[model samples]
Target chain A: MTAAAASDTAPLLPAARLRAALLADRAATLTQLYRRTFPAVERHVRRHGGTAADAQDVFQDALIVLYEKALAETLTLTATPGTFLVAVSRNLWRRELQRRGQHPTAELTEAHFDELPADESEAAPALAVLDYVQQLGEKCRSLLIGFYYHRQPLEQLAAAHQYGSVRSATVQKFKCLERLRSAVRAAWARTTDLLTA
Target chain B: MRPELTRLQLIEQHLLGPATPADASAWQLQTLLDPDLAADAAAQQQLYAGLQLAGRQQLRQELQLIHRQLYGPGSAGWLRGAAAGLRSLFKRRFRR
Candidate 1:
């Protein structure tokens, strides 16, 4: 999308604006999106037999799913961002209710649920591997997060992290990823060995 | 650089999508001939997945920080009021 088009339409809604902001260094836009979108999510969860804490948890999880989709370049909302968030939050809460052996209200149905581009099952391993990543060193931790998750441009990333150049930063990022890869590989091996034993 | 790390850097370039068209085709041919390279490529994909998880965790923390800032101590907003209302309701029920 052209920068002019993005800028012109950004203030229209949080959902439409979030994609552009996330692709660049625009934290203020993110904050605005969160603030504007979250209250509706909270109201939805609360009206559906959930507490404020439950709303917070559900909203955070939904936001994570939204962020992941945005990063993967696959999030397209049919509704406004707030409405989309409410639908996701409702689906998540219904699932939570089912898991707890409580019946979800008939009001909550899949008709309004936006089809996620990826399956929850596919996200399983991504959520599963987070525990292993926490054990990585500070530099490796930050480097991987900055490069892969945040999508920081290499030039800015190098300057922020004080790498001599983009090439060095790129090399360092790969090295950090390699270290994380090995650690995750080792952890999987241990789990497999335990399962087989 | 060791051969293995060099191979990883090459895979990273491919995964990151900056490889020249010719270079990517060459790497594809190399993967076809070399099982080890293919295996490493698959493993590298998994590594990217893991990194995505790491990134999500970082973003979650940052967001939760924002949540706290918006609703934490000394804050008075709709969210804070909502939270306080819930706390009192739960507190009253538990006290009974």
Candidate 2:
């Protein structure tokens, strides 16, 4: 089938379904999103002096932003999911241009693109925190992420991790969180010290 | 629950919850009166935000794997396969 025909027949997931897919990390739905939305992002990026590779990077970051919003349960789609992805890609590419000290192409006017909400601006620091999360060791990392990120219940986590009971799992989760908090605080302190020094 | 764990749970509830107005008010008053509690609350809030970021990171990795499976070097996608074939054909012809 032609690309257009394929897209025409593609199942467009509704907003709730999209959010659910993101929350569950469902590969099929996410793959469908990529197939449906990426071409438009690629075209827009190429038109604005970006390579296919640039488009890929911007599109990936946009998806991360969308995923974050979904995790926060704050995703409110104002248009088709494809259009939202394209708009986010546009914003991201525009930022990339500014970072590289190049003017955005005239076609990338502010009027033509949607400004992402302020919460999206926290992405960079959040990524840094993600690095800290990686340092939290495997057990703590899994426990914390399973609870907070995956939203898994204590009983389920207990079964998966072989904890004696839900109570033990809850205690473990609390301890892991405390460890994470301490580690992050120490890391932040070191960073702050470096800045001062 | 232990006192510290109970406090942590309260802070978590305030940060991410199910927190009732009364619970919120109590949390605010406690944090206001106790600087350490306030700091702990902030750190806990940051942790939740970090968890969301980590979740996004995981999802991004998953999407990237899907992208590679669909379009990367060894992908079975027809366009990429055709492009690779054409490139090799040109290289072979030029080298002759």
Candidate 3:
């Protein structure tokens, strides 16, 4: 079956509904996506001499890219979600091979080349700072994440988190952000010192 | 509001929102004159990037959990049945 026809049996989800389900962490919708798209990714990876575990890793990263694009309201699908997922998975797997110093047997088509997401070279530093986020205490972490990443409205966040008012939640979010900024600064300084030492 | 918090808000607005050209230029001038403000802005920008990365990481973990539930040895009965059907179909189509 063609990649577009791969997930034909699974009901197609509207892009908006898919975004909402992902943002809300709806398990059933995510399960449907996983069921629909994963097989193509697995087949592609296996054809390239990669293991099932490698396919899983590449598939997961592609989903993360898709999720972030949806969150940013920047997802512009020119094909079925299954096709898009397969293309992205192929690109990610190719990049992985290159990173491992293995030449990919399959050349990336122009379409696949354009599907690559953001550069991950900076991800290491960002991930290092993410470790500091955990040290900000659970309340702060949740407040910042709820506001920034989840994009929850301040009024809604206030009610959900038991703050007295939206203003209170806003204040708390700012404070949490400040704390995180300080931690990141400290981490940068430490890294600099280590490099210089 | 505390001056620090106010400055933080200004930096956030400059980075994350549509600042009027006036506001943007003013911010640029402020950062140019104030090294500390520039440093704070850079750090805040990195923090935003980190938050984005963290969000993706959290979503990946959630997806991984779903994947495990669907494919792991203890997957639900109906899911296992469906998977078996799909596997057979793949085998048939991909057989050399």
Candidate 4:
């Protein structure tokens, strides 16, 4: 992917270019922000139960959140790139889950979990949670993976799954858990009983 | 032979570890973790091993996808969708 070849074909749709084309006064700041923060946002959006479609949507939304916050010029960085990104991704996921009326757990954005340093040693080996969740059916697997990994609220789960409400979706959550359990068992070459842990 | 447990029981222990007094008394999950099931420890270990393997692989693939999406002209597993759009644009004659 050569940038020259890319520009030769289509204008860059990057944050830097988009800010330069659309906004006033904050172009340089936006570019620097894009360079500094966009990667973290992009990576988290990709892994946090979003498809490329979802990834693009979440990344853009988080950027907008940052943009709006920059009004105060206090969008400080208490956490590293990964934590900030995962936090935003988790919130977006919760909102998406809520819209669907599922029971997304408040546990989705566990501050303690996010506060942990982003050590490659502790980071799950996969490139992104999205790719791992891809191993399952998109609709079911994605929602389940969202809950499994991020604890997206049940209301959000229902919305994402299109269930009637949180309770109805809760049953599905159990089922989703069963499915995840099965997946882990099969992948591990373990029997169903062994999943008891 | 290993014993069976409910989804809730499994999840509680899987993510939270060991039966809480409340969990054991209320759900009767205490007996579910039978010592006979101890024989199945290998399976439990295997499940964790698999989850980690799958998780890491997924993460690797996703990062690659992001990398391509950012650096390349197209997204992962989605270039085919763009090709047709691009083909039509090529047909739109710029001023001769």
Writing each residue's lDDT as its tens digit, candidate 4 over B22-55 gives: 7556444534655533334434433333344443
Clashes of each: 0, 0, 0, 25
- Please tell me which predicted candidate would have the highest DockQ against the true structure: 3
For candidate 1, write residues A1-197 as lDDT tens digits. 43235657635445445666665544565566678877887787788777777777777777777776765566787776667777788888777666556544533322122343334356667655666668888877877777777776677678778999988988787777777777778888999999999
For model 2, what TM-score does chain A reach?
Answer: 0.63
What digit string (tens of lDDT, one per residue) describes model 3 on residues A37-144? Answer: 898899999999788888888787777677667656678777766777888899888777775565445432211223435444636766777888867798888778
Runs in model 4 deviating more than 4 A are A1-34, A37-135, A180-197, B1-14, B17-29, B32-60, B73-96
The candidate maximizing TM-score is 3
Q: Compute the interface RMSD for candidate 4.
A: 8.7
Candidates in descending DockQ order: 3, 1, 2, 4
Off by over 4 Å in 2: A1-13, A94-131, A150-168, A185-197, B18-20, B32-35, B78-96
Whole-model lDDT values for every prediction: 0.70, 0.73, 0.73, 0.47
Against the hidden true structure, what lDDT does model 4 obtain? Answer: 0.47
**DockQ, 0 to 1 scale, candidate 2:** 0.41
Give the proportion of true interface contacts each model preserves, from 0 to 1.
0.69, 0.63, 0.64, 0.03
**Ranked by TM-score, top first:** 3, 1, 2, 4
* lDDT of model 2, residue A26: 53
lDDT of 3 by residue, B1-96 (tens): 677888888889988888699988898899788878877777788788777766656767788888878777676835776888999999999995
